[model samples]
Target: MVKNLYMLPEGLPEPVEDGACDHLQGLALPSVTRPATSGGSVDLSELPGTAVVFFYPMTGKPEQPPMRGWNKIPGARGCTTQCCGFRDRYPEFQALGVSVYGVSAQPLADQKEAVERLRLPYPLLNDTDLKLAEALELPLFDYDGHRYIKRITLLVEGGVIRQVYYPVFPPHLNPTDVLAQLRS
Candidate 1:
């Protein structure tokens, strides 16, 4: 498929400056809803308590640098590791009284398939249209000259981003962060 205009015709405009989500800690993310894995829609926003949003690069395609994602490198160890980490520690997150969801620019089909492939118990938000990405002003890159999502995490509550995590390297590395958000 051809790239969209959002790309400087092929890539997003370089980020002017990183936002609060980059350095924020202890910020409470709000609940959000996207099309459900079962198809149609589900609204997590109505769920109670604080919410954590996991921002993952598209989990489809092989680790192809041409796809663009973490390290701006194709096929970088991105989604699987971090997500599995979350999966393993999901109970802990649950006890914290916070809901968690995964977000990506990939289409709904991809997100749904990923939920099944990973057997994720939570919902995945499809930001494929990129409205959410644009609002966040994410520092997108062209890997092997192709655009893809950045690897980051957001902690939000009540429609506000309380904390953001970048370079969530070493997947599944969940430290019991009492902070509002733990990206890594």
Candidate 2:
């Protein structure tokens, strides 16, 4: 059977909260420049106003087979769904003057493909060098000899992180959750 990238499989394990991101709140974003699908590097620290950055492991392409044991890894699945969710709700964020971004350790080519395939309104930043991840001390996992950032979301304003969501489960709903927090 063909796998559906947009639907999370039933019985997918839920990721538990870890204190890895606890210290992130109220910290100034580091001056890490990452290549964006929009065609230029962005310094998270220099972004003005509110911004939402959701970090995922990687996005799987439809033409390729799923990563080995991908579904079994908690928070490893749903990159595409999460991206689509943000794409769908991008207008709301734009109206609120919030910039949205997706980050992953995936290469720029892969991220570009995902952005085009998903029709994402926001750019997906390439963290292949892990500059942003290391600077922020984001949690990471290694699988098949490759390092990937664990699912996490950050709400940043004026270059400082004001809120952090760790072990973000049911990834598709993460954007909604962020929106709620922003509206509150």
TM-score of each: 0.66, 0.98
> What TM-score does prediction 2 earn?
0.98
**For residues 1-184, could you state the per-residue lDDT of candidate 2 as single tens digits?**
4678989889999999878899898999999899999998899999999999999999888878767788898889998999999999999999999999999999999999898888999999999989889988999999999999999999999999999988899999999999999999
**Model 1: per-residue Cα lDDT over 1-184, one tens digit each:** 4432111122323323345246345433333346666666645446455677777666754333334443335223446656666766778778777777777777788777767877787777777665555555655555554455676776666655665666554435532342324434
**What is the Cα-based lDDT of residue 73 in candidate 2?**
87
Residue 61, model 2: Cα distance from true site in angstroms:
0.9
Poorest lDDT segment (10 consecutive residues) of candidate 1: 3-12
Q: Count residue pairs with overlapping backbones in model 1.
A: 18
The runs of at least 3 residues in candidate 1 whose Cα sits more than 4 Å from the true structure, single-residue gaps closed, are 1-33, 42-48, 61-76, 144-146, 174-184
Pairs of residues at least 3 apart in sequence or in different chains that clash in candidate 2: none
* Index of the highest-TM-score prediction: 2
